[model samples]
Target: MKVNRFQVNVILGIANGIISALQTLWFIPYIKSFLGNEAYGYVSVINGLVNTLMIISVSVGVMSTRFIVVNLEQGNKKKASHYYSTEFFSLLIIGLLISILGIILSFNLRKVMNISSGYYNDVQILFLMTLFSFLIQLISAPFSASFYVKNSLFITYLIFICDYLSRIMMTIFLFSNGEKVIWSSALATDLVYLGMILIYYIYTRKNLPELILSKSLFKIKYLWDVMRSGLWVGISYAGNVMLSSLTTYFSNIFCGVIITGIYSAIMQLNIIENTVLSVLISSILPKMFKLYSNDDNQSLYNYVIDSMILTTLFIGLISSGIVVYGSDFMSLWMGKEFVKYRLLIVLTVIYLPFTLPSQVINQVFTVKNKVAIPAIATLLFGMLNVFLIIIFTKWLNLGIYGIAISAVIVQVLRDNIFYPLYLKNIINRVKWKLSIPFLIGVVYMALGISICFLVKKVIVPNTILSFSLSVIVSGILLFLLALTLYRKKEHLGG
Candidate 1:
């Protein structure tokens, strides 16, 4: 049997997913055990901030992928090279500026995050290390874009898995050796990224020689073109950073570092959902770009529709498991103290209904180059979410659940309800049928909620053996349902 590109991507995605999940599972406990909860919270904050800085790289990367693939489709190797080289140098400059910013910010670590004076040095060291690691990734963004342009994510993911595994082992060694400084873990992470820079450089030279650097590739015109295309992408990323990082910052300032630690644990588990969706997005985006460029409107519509339904069903199933067994899983995985965060965990699932489907829609927006509206909306709503979090926590005394609720509300309104409507107008060929997935998501979530009760009756919630059986059974059933729906919808759409 010959595996298709989509199959290859999915396989790689799953591999990356498992590796990421395992790393999170292993390292969170290791950090908590060795470095303690306060340090864990600081680590989470640092990581969040680093990812926030990634806005610069991601903006350039999205444009690089778009321009490179589109230009290649036109058989314009020079244009692709121009896009690659321009973005590469641009990201280098961005990385340097951020590195300087990181150094300056490192000095103010104690005041910035309210670090206790005793642990001030540790936080500063970790912050600096994280900054360096982020800087490396920033510079490597354009090279990573080469893989995406070629639709060769499997190779990229393969390298990443190796990197992740190496980091895990190194961190474990450091922890066991009493080198419990959080900066050591960050250093281990940077080393992997440095290795990736080298690997991607060699690989791009071998396979995508056209994407290599040249003086002719460094055109001011192409640099401006990239910046123009990437402007909204950068805005969207800034909004996302605000939403996620501000949540951590809020928890730290309002609730305390311990709660931030707890919140981070919840988010780490929640990342499993994002991991799967990210794989799906990466797998489909190159195709999405191609379909749009070819003016294959109907195929693009069907593709978006099918993907929306499939992502909804998949997320609904996982959300079901989380709804039914999240508390138990958290208790077992994190610690018994986490059982109290059950409601917050459940609230996070609300995002799945809106977020998962929107992941597919985002690709459509990107392909159409109409990302400005959605990006601006995200910024506005993200700020709204932050404001709501403040009001609910400080004024209404609602706490972290307030923050989670605000996020879900804003996402549903903006990304879910608003963005799809916007896409219908932009794509012009899309119809009201696109709304079907929303209805499906609602039903799925309801069923998932109902299953929580049915599950409790069938299997003891906290029992390891019983919970495992429930997940397996639910997963199989959900997978079958998703397959049936996908095939049925695809045939009907065709």
Candidate 2:
């Protein structure tokens, strides 16, 4: 039983995701406990602003991966190098400019964010450290792109695990010594980014030697080419950031800092689920891109359908657990105070089945270089999400729940309705009947939620150990059920 690259990548990715989630689990509570919820809230708002500004670098990174992989698949190493070099130099310039912008923003953070007079200087320091970390990541994006080119996400995940560990260790060291400031987290993050960038650079130079940085290889035309393909990716990423990060800013504005802190804490569960999902999906993307580039539409279609089912099942399992055990887990992890926000946790993730499976389809748009429409839809819906949040929170006085509800509505509209139809239109050669899998996904979610709730009723898990046991039992039962359903489908198809 020899393991393949994909299997290795998936295993490493899962491990990395778990580590990252644990880091979040520890980091969030530590910050809230030592620095207070207001400090944690300020840190979250600052980090959100940085993420919102990272759209350009993320777009460049994505396009660099796509272009590099596609060109390498075509046996054009020179073209791939050109794309890499162009992006590398471009990001350097972008990083410098953004650093300056971050400085200005840091000085005037009061105007943009709802910061208190007492914590203004501390928040500014946190903002600067976070901005510096982002700058490091921005410049290193091209180097990291090599892993995707080689389908070597195992290496990437390994590095990420190390980074997470370092952050945890640094935070513990800083906080234990009575340096319990919000900026300590950002300082830890900066060190982690510095280490990660060095590792990425060394790995790319040694293993992926074909990707070279040279002034000669950097072309204006190549920059134009990458940007032409990447602009939509940037727009789509902007929408995603708004939906996630900008919501934190809105929370500060509408509900106040204390509530924003609590909302940010609850959203950590959402972050963990997404971190895992993104890692799993990223493991398969190189293969998907390869299939598309080779004109293997039938195989690509099959691959996509399988991915949709698997992604849906995974999210369903996680969502069901959240819906059932969220309060118990939150009580154990954060404190009984957080248990009151259990409904917010449910709202944060309840729409995954409707949206995430469609995300698999949405990737096809990127593969086919047909992202304008989807990107526009995402941006439009993101704006709608903000508008609805304001209306619900202010006018209707729905408060924090308003933000969650708005997200669910917008996601269902854009991802559920638009993405599948758009995918059907673009992948026209394959006559993809998405209804079967879509219906199957619905069934999976319904059963998962119902059975998990039944388990909760049958076995009360008050303590941590009891909760762990309950989760294990329920997870295994769901796994077995999913396996049976998948095998039956395969048999019928056969």
Candidate 3:
């Protein structure tokens, strides 16, 4: 039997979430114990710096997906194939160039960032590790974009499993041998990612008929289109990297590395949450591209409304659950020291829903060929985030918590205000069809909060049992409420 979209999304989401939870939340304790807090902070900060550089070298993969999906929707298979082929080669070339450039520039990096002399070696190795990771990722994306269009989420999950499983094994090995933990960790896991990329390419060559190109994909038209589309994409990545990846460099100079570690843990949670949401939304966008291409306005409208409603319900439920239990669970995973500030985690729990609206809104734009909205929103958010961090960090005396709060505020502005405004501007309207999603989200959120409180009061201590029970009970209650509401609406000729 063919898997439905919901089944595919749920399976892949759960699979990846399990690995992420183990790798991120679980590994924190392991790394903190082995490397000590200061060392862990150093590794994480360097990792963040590397990610900032990577946003420049890579990140056009999303724009690649949008372009490829559009061509596929227009039934232009050969052009789509050529596009992916070009993307694969272009990204490899860029990755090699960036890696070489970074190595050459490493000598000046310490002075450029003004880090203490003691931390220079650590920063250099971290930069090299990050560069390698980017190369692996750049190669994976062209093949991975095929999976996105085909809804091969299981393949995506397999990629993540390879990554996290390597992390776990290496954590054990590095801890045992007293090796340089950061470099060992990076070497082990990045090799795993590259191996997975090789596997994905093999599969794509055999399985995906749409990706097979015979002649060189060096035609000027294809090169021009990819470059033009990817220029905006590069700018968008620059903005996102400014907001996120560059934070550690800024924090180290202006704030401190210990606090950056605390912030890093929060970011790990954010990544896991957003990754799940992206998997949920990804399936719909590809399908919606077809509807939009055919000029099926009604179907497009319904898809938009339903996607927002579902995302709101899903993310709101998660946020409430996290708010109630996140601190307790993380306290167990890491330590009380790391968990000292309940307020940051609590603020993060509150912030998840506010930050979630953009996923759907941005997808709406992607399917409709309006990529400029996200680029514009991300650019503005980037500038505003820098200003807020500087203001909150040095002046407010609020410390790390202030940074977290400022980050959340910027996301809320981007997700809740800026994204919708972009959508309305581009689409030139916001129907009740749009507002109904907002209202449905409100209802689900209210119900979810109530359920979260009840679960907190009644939940027991066994991890496996508690997780299973929560999933089951939440499913039943949500299903009944949705069924009743749908029936009532149908009675009124909805």
lDDT of 3 by residue, 1-494 (tens): 99786577668777787677777766776777766555556666677667666665454566666667777777887878887877777777788888778788776776546445666786677668767876788777787766666766677677777777787788788778766455666777678877888888887787677676444874667766766666666667777776767666676667676766676776666666677677677656666777877888667766776666666666666666666656666666666664576777777657666557567877776666566658766887888888888888888877766667777888778777777777777775565455555555566667776776676567653475675576457556665655555444433323
Off by over 4 Å in 2: 430-432, 491-494
TM-score of 2: 0.96
Report the lDDT tens digits of candidate 2 across residue range 286-379: 8888898798998988888777777777777788788888888988988899778888989998778668777888878877778888888888
Model 1 TM-score, 2 decimals = 0.95
Clashing pairs in 1: none
In model 3, the Cα lDDT at residue 280 comes to 72
Over all chains combined, what TM-score does candidate 3 have? 0.87
Better of 1 and 3 by TM-score: 1
Stretches of candidate 1 exceeding 4 Å from the true structure: 490-494
Model 1 lDDT tens row, 192-219: 8888889888877887777768666788
Best-performing candidate as measured by TM-score: 2
Q: Each candidate's TM vs. the true structure?
A: 0.95, 0.96, 0.87
Of models 2 and 3, which has the larger TM-score?
A: 2
Compared with the true structure, the alpha-carbon lDDT of candidate 2 equals 0.83
